[model samples]
Target: MTTPTRARAARRTACAAALLLAVTALPTSTAAATDAASHVEGQLPSGATYMMDVPAAWNGTVLLFSHGYTPAGAPNPAQNGPDAATKALLLDRGYALIGSSYATTGWAVTDAVPDQLATLSVFTDRFGEARRTIAWGRSYGGLVTTAIAERDADRIDGSLSLCGLVHGGVANWNNTLDPVFALKALLAPDADIPLTGLPDQAAATSAANALTAEVDSAQSTAAGRARIALAAALHNIPVWNQPTQERPAADDWDAQQANQYQAVKGLLQIAAFHRRQEAEVRAGGNMSWNTGVDYARLLGRSSVRKEVTELYRKAGLSLRADLATLNRAPRISADPGAVDWMSRTSSFTGKLTKPQLSVHTIGDALVPVQTESALKRAVTAAGSSSLLRQGYVDNAGHCTFSPAEQLAALHTLEDRLTTGKWRGTDADSLNSRAAAADPTTPARYVPYRPTPYLRPYDLAHHSDGQ
Candidate 1:
């Protein structure tokens, strides 16, 4: 999943940045600084357990990072992956590193915060005295981070959400733009209907036959395509069909179970299902891997609601037979009723008066740029747009900070937090202007500039600002 070359490059970049920052901030003849390594493990309020690492020369500041959904019993990916990179970056700067498992993976939100706070409480006791603390997360971790920020503003000094799903239940309840996934969601859940143990050939044959029939009966219309497109966007994947994209296998279906423990995995499972389905179709085999079936089955129903005109049209099927089934929507977990949690209350970006900065990639495939956009809008809506600074990089990936500009952005964030300064970009300016007039208006995001660095560089030679 990672390589030595990339890790080396990241380390060099972070080290150089830390050095520059230290050179400017530290006394020329600095006093001896003590460096120690320690860790703490405990249970969270939500009845979950977590672990954290604190540097010995800690400055009483903490940076708590979160992990997204992963396979059950999987090693915490954040600690060794980006968490290592982040720790190497901040630990040298005198910040204690902390991380927690969110109760169980998938979508379990019940114990998410209690678990995190529990970790924080243990840290406060272990480290003794803290002046500053901030929360940060990626993907589902982002959602967790946001939820924490919303309810525990007093505890969190600042927050950074990266490629996370902040919108909550909306994206899940909806169907994908891919017609196959939409059809798959129409499946009815049955305890007796064993799928995983079936021979691949047999399952493929059954799924393919069902899918083909639906396709033949679908109402091919422009509105139908638009509906499908929306579904695809929700899943963060491209539409499937004539091009033959793959969907994940049956067991992978476990991830799509959105019931608290597997929400993140469920999303990944959906992606895998689509990829596999595409592969199978391309290979001229049965089309058994269907998202529509998974979604419907989860909700305990066999078909989509008739009021879903857009879906029927997109499927391009003869709707006459299923119209009656459609009149009464299937009782499924994917139903809008099952996902009312997102709309229960409008989430605020919180009091934006504090110095804040957001960094994002223009081409991130997983978390759309829209998450940041919504956040910016919320801040602007609160008339605190001036307090936020945003940075975008064209070629970076998730939580990725590769370009010289991104390095500069981190410096900018550090400066704002410690010095109470604020910076602006064209995108930030545009967002501010839009929000000034209508606080409730949505945030408009601009992509990053596209340009390759002209320098032939090594980590030692790289320096943007810090």
Candidate 2:
């Protein structure tokens, strides 16, 4: 990755401006769908839009798709599911596909869960009840789907969450806060980048730009690189997926650092910074806190700690001082009322009454792979561990999976539903199944373990503060 020099900074600024314009240019209201012989579209009284596609030969099962987060002002896709190929594959298999654009966007868990249920109700009312209903969601939709599974298990036969934030809302927000806090302490210690309570989009954008500049300046020095590595480690941001660039090998320190620099830069500028502001607005105050967080402890417990250490060693920088600095920095606290609101509106209980199969990319920077571990722990605590199965893709990026991988996952869940047992879930087995399903898009399943979440978060606390 090239250093974020003046030219590069200018390019980044231009790109951000272009993105802002594009987002703002989107139509405020959802567009009316063009109905086809096999497709149906409708809108609820609340203005939430929904679309459904049925194959000529209808299968008994319906695949309800919950889409990921849509940044405010961006146009929501008319149909459900992750990509066009997945929708095509499902339709070819004779399954029905349905999805909804919740009435409002931006941290819309409150609207999404019920809006989706309303969509299901409309679907059932239009056509006969599906023999089996499988709820599947990607990213934020994954959280929505999981919530449905827990609270409305009777409505669906099974569930699949792809790259989902199954980790409770509190944990998700707090975990993101880790790296942003580190960036502030190490790079822009005195910058007016508010970690919370962003007054508006302009304020959020300013903060994001400031942090991005800091990251750009720091990318040119060894100490700066080492500090970034620490920040990335805290969030387990993968040192892969540099834009339009091939991923570096695991042991390639220089290449990995470059990739990590890009990752951290993006995280601070858009993923963590901008998204948190939107979330704060929806929650009515700041919902994330780092008040009592211990940075050293967080780093020690991180999945990328070893990688961070190696990167620091290669950069000839002392990691200890940075850790100490983070420990001494003043922390941000959350508004209790806002925290409670987010907890109620979002978060999962893990009390699964139906089988759920979750698929995640091992190196997902947006929603860290540790989210799976946190979900596993919650289900175990709820005595619903038996109902949950997780699969990992040996790749990087957020929700980066081929149609083959997704079809194979759906099949895996279908198998459990059909035979009352898991079949072909091992990495090798799943890869084979995915290849057979679609030889065009090869599978990338791999056996890997994810680290446990460091924060104290669970359904019990989020549900009612019990």
Candidate 3:
């Protein structure tokens, strides 16, 4: 399994390759004419950059795209859509695409919600109102897209959230913190790693590197690997990381353990430590806690309990001592003010008023497939389950859908909106449509149900203390 860091680098390389292909495939004059006729770029008063593209034969429908999170100080590209292939296909099919380089990049959900709306306002003011509008986003952008669908249902017709953290903010952050808390208790009890409130990017990166090194060293032994599996299970990290391979078998201890270690390391460094730091800065303190949590109970309820048991049995070890140690360790507590702030700023109450179609990779480690489950529960509780449909691709890796898969999801949502009912959304049917559209990349759709979220922020759903 490729490490999370390496997988990200590979995605960047693939994007570069796609950009190169897009450039070389088009004649220079044709490219220039297309840009001249359809492309428009501008900036909002708040310094958010935006770009819009409309085809010569307008379809009267617009796709508003919200991009994934960008780290602070990273270059914010004016991406008009999710990927090169998707963008090309949308334009070819005569749908207008628009996107905003959201103001203040790192975890900018507060700014993104309004900034994206502002960009849409600008588009309507200049080009006239779109006859139909669909809000779409990937990863973090998916959360933003859902917020828009909930808050501006009258303005948008439908929404597509691809690999989004739709489980709401409190649950996402608390779940991320679970592994870090477990790692600290079981692996580095004496290490001076600040789990939250990092002063800056340098501090967060330094902490992440330190945690990664500890995880790397811990992977050398069977007991250490068992503890890592405990942490991974608490967060619902998938046992597969490679996109081209099937999930490792239960008894394939070596392969399964390696993937679990990677998941733990990646979650601690990126999601728990670094992202938590940024989130703490926004929330004014730590918003995650494990106070009064029962480690033994958490382990028993974990989806990967059987896998952990198998690993311990193969390694001639017992998990009882480790779980006891975790139970005895001092637990972290959240500041009340910070918890309130995060709850207000991050969580979604379902409350769906528009048609929403969410797509996720079955083996997404970072966001995890269980997020979709949480969202489903939320929508059900809100009595809007009729408005929601979720589809999954069989591949591993986060947001790793091919263009055909993505377009097929869009078409599925369009079908729902047009017919007022979901049509052909089963894995076989969706995969057949995707394959028919683009045979180059075979569809990997499967009927895989994810486990329930382990550390949901909702007290009713959480396994541990509220």
Q: Name the regions of candidate 3 deviating beyond 4 angstroms.
A: 1-37, 244-247, 458-466
Model 1 scores a C-alpha lDDT of 0.43
lDDT of 3 by residue, 10-114 (tens): 546645765211111222112111212357788898899999887766676788999998876689976779888878877888888998999887778888888
lDDT of 2 at 260: 73
CA lDDT of each prediction against the hidden true structure: 0.43, 0.80, 0.79
Mark the regions of model 2 whose C-alpha exceeds 4 Å error after superposition: 1-37, 242-244, 461-466
Order the candidates by TM-score, highest first. 2, 3, 1
lDDT (C-alpha) at residue 293 in model 1 = 36
**Candidates sorted on lDDT, descending:** 2, 3, 1
After the best TM-score superposition of candidate 3, give how far the Cα of residue 397 lies from its true spot, in angstroms: 0.3
Candidates 1 and 2: which is better by lDDT? 2
Q: Report the Cα lDDT for candidate 2.
A: 0.80
